[model samples]
Target: MTSKSGRRVLVADDDEAVRRVVHRHLEDAGYRVESVPSGVEALARLRGAERPDALVTDLQMPGLDGLALLMEAKRLDPALPAIVITAHGSVETAVDAMRKGAYDYVEKPFHKDVLLLTIERALLHRMVLEENLRLTEALAREFSLGNLVGGCAAMQEVFRLAGRAAPTEAPILLLGESGTGKELLARALHYNSARAGKPFVTVNVAAIPESLVESELFGVVKGAFTGAVASRTGLFQQADGGTLFLDEIGEMRIDLQAKLLRTLESGDFRPVGSEREEHADVRIIAATNRDLGTAVEDGAFRRDLYHRIAVVVLRIPPLRDRIEDLPLLLRHFLGKLGAAGLEISSDAMKHLADWHWPGNVRELENELRRAILLRGSTGSIQPGDLSPEIQAGRPPRGRGDGRLDLRAIEIPDEGLNLSDLEREVISKALQKTGGNQTRAAALVGITRQTLIYRMEKHGLK
Candidate 1:
């Protein structure tokens, strides 16, 4: 018998002998027991400032019966765990009491051990419920919109759009570079929405093999395929009444994109090899790193599907564009990585700011982790603690006068075309780098894919 020393139990019965017997049993089992002869008096004690942890009441009370008392008690504290005591012939009433919100029912002439065990189980159930609630609240706070760290104008705009759109049922498309926090934003939206208590399922489209993508999203009936052995629930069904975050949506196969589009439009999808169609009320939040408009133009992505998921598009800017947020992000990551006490030297901070983070925030966090490990016994991180690429930094793009060193180019009286200027800069970068797209992209401070897109747009060789 586990000693429930401080646990308080309230016992109510119309019979004086029953109350005394129950009180003595509960007290002997190490519980602080309070006995009342009527449900009315028990209700009064429940309504008082100090409430017991569990309730035990007899079903046939005078004015307020056990069933009524149980309902009222649950109404006052929705999570209150109540157990009802009933006579041997009142098994049906005990069942009714359970339906009215009693945790369990104990028939008359029950052994003391039986009563104590039921109380123990009821308290355990209440403990589990409280723990789950605490965890849910903590997750809500962690993913709250206000908790996302960003102070730059670009991030502020992103936050503003997310705040306004989070409460809506419209489909959302997140566009950004690979390392931008698109998935984090998606979670924040889901956790803040009306369906916060429901599931939030995520699927990385690019990660799954092409052969399994369809079945993974829409599920499979048992024996639907050669080796599906058991019936499987898909991401869409699992996220019913909640959210489905499709990561790397651009990488989804064209055939599967059509299926995804159909599901989004109709909210009905047939599991692979299944004759019947299943309906799931799920909100879609898709994310991608590719330039979808270009993909649609190139006939790679379906235009109809693009429009469906892009009802509300939010673009997360790359780290380079929001350099001012570096300090805030550094502190945020350090605290998250459990190195909150570690400090960064001015030289190290300068290197971090200067480096063009192709991998964005994800890379920055990884770099911080590495630096923390290399910081050794030193309380502060120095420039040498950073990666070599970051230590080398980028060649100065600005002059001592705090202006871009574009003095080599002169604007003629007629003025030059900006497009021509852009083309020339890109072409020169490619020519200077021996047509190596990666190096050329680095010289131009753009992603290799972006450089290729521009080169194709300019009809560059």
Candidate 2:
């Protein structure tokens, strides 16, 4: 009765007869089965390189009893489902096992069909858990910090603090401007921690409706309110054993903030319309552009919660402060654009760096994207290709008098003739240099022969 799925099962029992019976039945039912004489051997087998698909063990095994083994096994592999085997009339202990997170339990002297059925259910659960983990990992890829770019002093400090805090279970508070990549830092912390393979959930407090914020954070039970037909788990439960990012925490209403504070303090929360409280094992990482200290003074944010979440605060510097990183950031974005043929001129780069980036890195990326498209076949971005505000912010171009002035040469709407302007500039340069082509060329930062050729072309006798 070998199982075609090639699923593996580990059975541990002190009684040789019981172990042989379970092993034979499971193997005949088309599963690869292994048996251990004691809970100690069962643990060793579970801790081995090849983990079984499911575990079944006796509750009263000598040394490292089934309950302790189940806990240790789950600690090693959270997704591994298990069934506890107990003597008949020991239903109390079986209930305790359930409280401790067992998938199911089978009474001793049970029929072979019953044991097989329990094992099947446990295996199905294990499959579901594995699929959930896979999907969570896929979603986490969106916020991965593997590609974060910056090497400035301010950003280096940020990375240092983030690296120091990632391995611990403490809640982290990220403070920064709107576009300073706070959420990105939070994801870095999660991926670098022990729970990297687990779910990483994000919730924007400002985005969700105030009325539904509680249910959204802690979940909702059926009949909780209007349109509540089915029970739903909240973000906290979904992010259990992983990280939960609370973006824009300062925007949460005061009342709802209190409930959040309780969860942060005790790791226990009650779903809407449910009397029972559930425990969540989630690491919280909250971020906000607003100053929570100001909000606390205004009675908008909870002080206790602030202290709880800000145990290790990391501040992300605004792009303006990290202007030295512009070149690196620019290269990073240009490479991402995949425009192998395009480059940026030095004047265009100066224009980019001079402007105060009120919108931060996000605006810079958007501007670069627009420039890449608008460049067309030009092959390089110039000062004129940038927005009018950016061009207006450029350093003043010098006048013929050798004085810097704000007044720039303006062309009429119909556009001035380029030949007329070039001829006028050459005649004036020759007059200023006493008709000497060398001094005139030096004045205009060009070679003497180029100046003579321009003079002849303009018919400047």
lDDT of 2: 0.83
* Candidate 2 residue-wise lDDT, 1-461, digit = tens: 32337899999999999999999999898999889999899899988999998889899987889999999988988888889989989989998998888899999888999988888888877777777778757645654555678899888888888878988998999998767888778888898788888878999886777788899999999999998999999999999988899998876766777889999889999999999999999999999876677566645567898899999999888888899999888898888888655789999999999976766788788888888877655669988777777778733344122333538856689998888987888888889978976567556544343565567777887
Candidate 1 residue pairs in backbone clash: none
Please name the candidate that would achieve the greatest lDDT relative to the true structure.
Answer: 1
**After superposition, candidate 2 runs with Cα above 4 Å error:** 1-3, 10-29, 33-52, 55-87, 90-103, 107-117, 127-147, 194-199, 218-242, 255-263, 266-283, 295-308, 334-348, 370-461
Weakest lDDT window of 10 consecutive positions for candidate 1? 394-403
lDDT by residue (1-461, candidate 1, tens digit) is 33498999999998999999999999988899999999899999999999999999998988998888999999998888999998999999888878878899998899998998999999999988888778767878999999998999889999999999999999999999878899999999998888787889999986787788899999998988788898898999999999999998877767888999999999999998899999999999999877788767756688999999999999999898999999999999999999898899998998999887878899899999999988767779999899877787753333121225788867889988998988999999989989987668656655444576678888997
TM accuracy, model 1: 0.74
C-alpha RMSD of each candidate structure in angstroms:
7.3, 17.8
